[model samples]
Target: MILRSPYPDVEIPEVPLPEFLFGAGFGDRGDAAAFIDGATGSSVTFDELTGMVTRIAAALHERGLRRGDVVALFAPNSPAWVAVFQGVLRANGIVTSANSLYSPAELAHQLTDSGATMLVTVSPFLDRATAAAAQAGLPDDAVVTLDPVDGRTSLVDLLGSSATPPELEVGPGDTAVLPYSSGTTGLAKGVVLTHRNLVANLLQFTPLGTTDETTRILAVLPFFHIYGMTVMMNHGLHRRATVVTMPRFDMAEFLRVVAEYRLNRLYIAPPVAVALAKHPLVDEHDLSCVDVIFSGAAPLDAELGHAVARRLGCVVLQGYGMTELSPVSHSMDERHPDDDLNGVGYAIPNVESKLVDPETGREVGPGERGELWVRGPNVMSGYLNNPSATAATLDADGFLHTGDVATVDERGFFRIVDRVKELIKYKGYQVPPAELEAVLLTHPGIADAAVIGVSDAEGEEVPKAFVVVQEGVTLTADDVMAFVAERLAPYKKVRVVEFLDAIPKSASGKILRKDLRARENA
Candidate 1:
């Protein structure tokens, strides 16, 4: 059989997207704890949050922004960061959430590519922001500073506005969120997510909140990443559950939050699993409230998941999806547990998945391994400004061809087998090795650097770099890893390195990663 959805597409609401979710669930729960920001020790209620969002929309409208305009948000996990996002959405404007640590050049690339009209960022990055804004064709007035900055549109001023929006209509099909995907081999393309696309996925997993009332969830994954953005934050808020936010992951500090907040659910990536299995700090914290721990982005070793689950007295579950899919296509709930930890879990409701043989591009048997393709409302409309790429990734019938090598069992569970592309998923974040290779080449002392993903203790992969230095210059593995660390995001950091004489390449000069993996095994 060819790859076709046995089920039809999930229904999308024809109503205007932004205001459609107001007062739907969590009635009279506005005063309930919604977000507990760890960095500043601040807690915000649902009512407080919606009010802030409304003001943000009013201020943006006052500045002449209209529906479909794009705003860029570059900040960590803070209450303010989320408020800006909801404000952007509530106004019927889209937001591009950039990695906070991204270099000015990186920010400029995304801004220019996405044609963002405005930017909201922290005061600390003003200089870089200003320069990047110019490069992206934005004016000084377009820069909205989230904190006290001498010469910028203050976020406080926007928050103080009390004007009501024009009672506008929005719907699930309208574009609301614009997150970039580290395209398999090129520039990161903006993945357009309709409010309905995201709202649908959030509601699909809302039933998993059975214990959320008594359980606080650790929100360490970057909200900028779709998995963390929708799965944890949006879902947690819709459930009226408390979210304990961590701007950055610190092994020691992470364990402390669990004890401090009595956290019950931990939505983490594979690296955390590897650390918990051996990190001494895991033993010190009180994790009694932890009931379900879901890991994603990178692969999870069944052995490691089992060991960590046994040690922590919690259930370790694995999940799978990509940015183009509004992230979550499937996950292991309490019912399936570790039986399908290696698999992403059963096909989620409203989603139809298929496993196609690589050579023939035809569907395979229940136990056969192939490429996983999906058709659902959550699938992106297409890549921004790149029709060729959009056509290459999304099929004629709207099925997204997820390049992961996987197999689905008779029970509908899918397991990722290998990868067909050069993207590196470090703890659920895309760290394309080619991007790193391009950066490494700019260093004068470095003759060449070839980066590849190496398995961590938990079976997830991190970039392990092999470098060859200029004949006259002496270099060490430590020097190379640190060099990349200064330019990459936390998850994209290079953890291990080795000095190499040469990197295997083709006649046209493409790094042969499979050969490198084979050499590592040998």
Candidate 2:
């Protein structure tokens, strides 16, 4: 009952990540612009990028870092960030990327869990990085800045005098990047992606676009996110396209950069698409150069997608994937654009998908809603350091349970209906309910708490807390929200609070989230 990809199978190369990315056919594009700093108007050519990668790799090797060591990157999007990421790979080390907006506690958990030996970040985040490093039991020198500071070791200091890259044996099956994701339940875990997984995804995504040396791509999405890491940064470099990087997203600045650079391709989330559709600032700028916009990370409403496409007079498409699937399994083909705009489109090359009944464990046919099970070279190796979690996610038959409910049309297109997991999607970023509940329980006045996502006025899902207060203590919603706001990122903050007499739980003491969701909707 497994449904295969409509496209022909693609050849997945067995070489290491660095070799597959920078080897044989990538030469002669030396002078082409690889990445551009959107703010500073600075540019790095393909030849210079390769040389920087090698120098950084040599520096890392000289600093006593050996193959298989984990290096953490905690910086915003920039051309330099790209070099640092690729440099880690070229050094034969694993790269663990952290969200630039993370709080110190959040960062510390990732650092400790990933066992990162060194942390690389910018000066703006030095205070938080230092705090997190100390909390994680890393040395003072373990945290370094990307740029040269008065007293800190900059990335330049680690660069070796020689331009030759270090030579090391890296297998296709070796773990390359460790990106954190909350699979179906609980806190985030490190997703172990191998060299083969990344290379295969890159090859699989090639036919979906017409990117070339002349293509100018706007890369405003955070590189720490898997969608940006693979589709925008890695794919842009592999295609030798001109990529414009933004440190953060500002509506005015985003439009200015697009008009200034004449960027043609945009990779963004659903919320940004809403801005393009309804914001008046969009009409003030000249966005005629944009040819395509691809939305991912969350489901984009069909009406909003069409509105943006109509306003821009361009094609708008959606794709679907999780961090465990190298971030993309199905995307709309550039060659045959869908007019309906509801489906995320057909599976890309080399990936197969099937819809199954979650309760029955039996495959369902087209036009029936069921949990999606995908199998492909793009599937991750497993969750790092959590064999039980890995066993629960990746099956013996090699399919990764996505925990998302979807339906397939007769023509092979797929559309997401709902999520079966408790992870809330706040404008595409994951907000785990269990993590928020754990934080709420720490408050002295709170006896019990349960969190669930409720739709806001903007159609985006936000975290709402239902709390049970201590018998004689009084607490306000602001106090409850301020407590969480101090420890969590802005996106993970509790947006709404409701006090209850008691929390509904099972006999085993597990909070029934489905009951809370139903109450919220009712």
Candidate 3:
């Protein structure tokens, strides 16, 4: 059964991302504060942002960056990062955004795989960036710092060039950004997002957000991630909203900035929602200004989502997406503030989705769980230089197999169950880890938890949980087991419990389940 967006399709303009963003409709707010540094309160006006982008483009073009060349942005979230990102696109170059938390080796892997010719970073990260650049065989001169550093090329140097911005040579089909993702499974590979992919998602998502010139968006998530890149950075720019950028997420600092700036719209991952719902620090701040809290990058428990909504007295929304779909295919429309918080509401404009049985390769109707296949202009073209992986994911009909199990209702509301590969089979019964994780999170003693399939002494596969107990709460393994047992089926009960100080997560806020499996094997 194919499901189309409930909303009318918005026309996608056949223009490059830079042209579409800086041209008629999106860029007219000249002097408005486009971005603000949460820590310093410095602002970048729309005009100033455009000017910086122009100068940076001119400088990069003068320094040998050409069409199809790849530039690696390894810096944290900042106005300068935005400038460089747009600048590279303006110069007809592709951008590969690297996670700011990447180690030298990890960064090197991306730099090498993406075939990045130059790297842009800040002074603090210069050591690792330089090491990775060297490992990737990038020349020393190819490393540019966003902040001024003696003996290094800096943003100041880039903007000081007198050369004019190069002519825009790319079209809508040209590559824009390469954000790495593990897709359904396996190692992280670059997902080739074109100008049309980015721009189409922007148009498709804009109607559902309710953002305008007056909206204040808190961008605490890393901009390197596709969720932050497309949803927060580009969408904010497209909507002319004031985006407050934070280099890192600290609970105290996050609360302070939101309260201080009176930020209304918050884009966050599920992990941050935990703090808002349970952390004592949240109550210390005046969060009445918050209007909506949007969560993505992972499935959020409905119980926890309600807790956050009740505590903040704001509308809580959740969406479903993956990096390959230009990050957003479904979202809860702001118009329906009372929509079920558990389901990611209707598909956005121009998006078509299908719930197909993975085992049977048959279409499934509403209320049946199946793998989600999304087709839209926003769907990524394919993985870079990985044809086998691309063929395995994106079909000839243009539907990208998301590999996530989902169910849709009669009203077209979609609920994500879990990854097809992550489901636990106990005694021939299927148990979804997300369901058990949601149940585990409801326990008052549990702060955070992750469910994974582990082999038992009898060689049978069963569900095991890695939990983080709430601080100052005394909870035992049996108590945890009983808490879930009373709430779930026998097969769905967490059979093993291990306490940890924290759960490992990526910069995008996805739980590192592989790390947990490796630890179990070790």
Candidate 4:
């Protein structure tokens, strides 16, 4: 079933987004429970959350913050993390989320790039946040710690100042979030998402499929990332659905939550899907109740997508969106949701997507692979502080030139083939590493796989396979290469197989392709 755009054309709001998000759930007020921490069984109702957010907003406002201000949230996924997310919105400030797991160097880059004046973080991350702040030229007033230490103000105490929330001018064009994109070719760049960009996405998901008061979701996906921020946090709350938040994914616990909460909707990345489908432990846990399984951030193989669906008797839907797009431009229509269970089904409400040649701007026809370009309210305003990169990625026409090469079927179903910049040129024909990796995942013995291009003695780039074997399974390099050669085209075949314990991933769940490229150079 082709997903139809509800608006056909993206409808931009004249006002800012806090008004939209605030109004979305307040009516439920005391009745709606917003977040349920899966780990601790702790839950926060919408009214309680809004109260905390109001106090947080009041404290921040008293501390000299106002509209259009940029604040950074660098912490693990927890009730506090989410409270602060909404607090920033209520305070009329933009938020830039940094992963709690990031190294000082990685954290420093985003802090500096986004020009975040103040930061809210937990105790364990104080040193890293302090160092990053200094590097970013922020002084003592700029760093605020949530779990108080000697130097930092207590978040709880700060909230006691006033029950009243801050009021300021914030609009659709006024930036609301600065989520960094997982740049395929270079350093991660901050994608500027306005309040409209965010609210539009929340609305866009409304028409994608069936989501309402009855829907229950497993919110293990990181809130700092675009996918979880939009699909799990914003959308779930907008619909007044119960969100069972898992700080991290443990296979047994994930199944436990599904069974206990009767979780109907699940949004997962490719790696997690691989674990659910192939892991033996999955059998121990009953996932028979799941309604929607969404895989994004990376490609999910059709065989794997079909396997999970068949096992649970649930329709698997693959969605395609990026940090800049408020992340859900194409979600399968629930009516025909299973039609492209293997495909990233049709455009979401009010969003427009086009496939074009990477080198040339010319559009492609049905089934022809090309770089995908998207434009909508869901699309971000631009990259933070980097006009050059922003200008390069987003043309004057406002379409985000996503570097992903994909093909669309006649029915509006699309498949992300590989990254345009990451494609390996082998003997002049383009070799998609993702394609080879998908084939690698289909192998029974393989638990995880990442494909990168490496230079051969012949002075041409060749596909190299990095394989992680399943527990208790063993394989030789030649064996894995032979397995790939049988399935892939001659040029696209894996020429080298390197065994790895596991593939590295960013907090947002993107495989660090650049690290593999560095290893290739090594």
**Which lDDT value does model 3 have at 60?**
96
State each model's CA lDDT, in order.
0.75, 0.85, 0.92, 0.80
Full-model lDDT, candidate 2: 0.85
Rank the models by lDDT, top first: 3, 2, 4, 1
Kindly provide the TM-score of model 1 when superposed on the true structure, using C-alpha atoms: 0.80
Candidate 2 has a TM-score of: 0.82
- Model 4, stretches more than 4 Å misplaced? 1-13, 148-151
Prediction RMSDs, each to the true structure: 9.9, 10.4, 1.2, 2.4
TM-score of structure candidate 3: 0.98
**Models sorted by TM-score, best on top:** 3, 4, 2, 1
TM-score of each: 0.80, 0.82, 0.98, 0.94
Point out where model 3 deviates above 4 Å: 25-28, 182-184
Model 3 C-alpha lDDT per residue in residues 1-522, reported as the tens digit of each score: 789999999999899999988865444578889999999999999999988999999999999999999999999999999999999999999999998988898899999999999999999999999999999898998999999999999999999999988999999999999999942245789999999999999999888878999999999998889999989999999889999999999999999999999999999999999989999998789999999999999999898999999999999999988889988999998878788888888899999999999999999999899999999999999999999989999999999999899999999999888888898999999999989888888888888999899999999999999999999999999999999999887778888999999988887788889999989989
Q: By the TM-score metric, which is better: model 2 or model 3?
A: 3
Clash totals, every prediction = 7, 0, 0, 1
Top-lDDT candidate index = 3
For 117-192, candidate 1 gives per-residue lDDT tens digits of 9998888878888888988888888998888787677889898777766445456667888888743355667888
Model 1's C-alpha root-mean-square deviation from the true structure amounts to: 9.9
Candidate 4's displacement at residue 96, Å, is 0.8
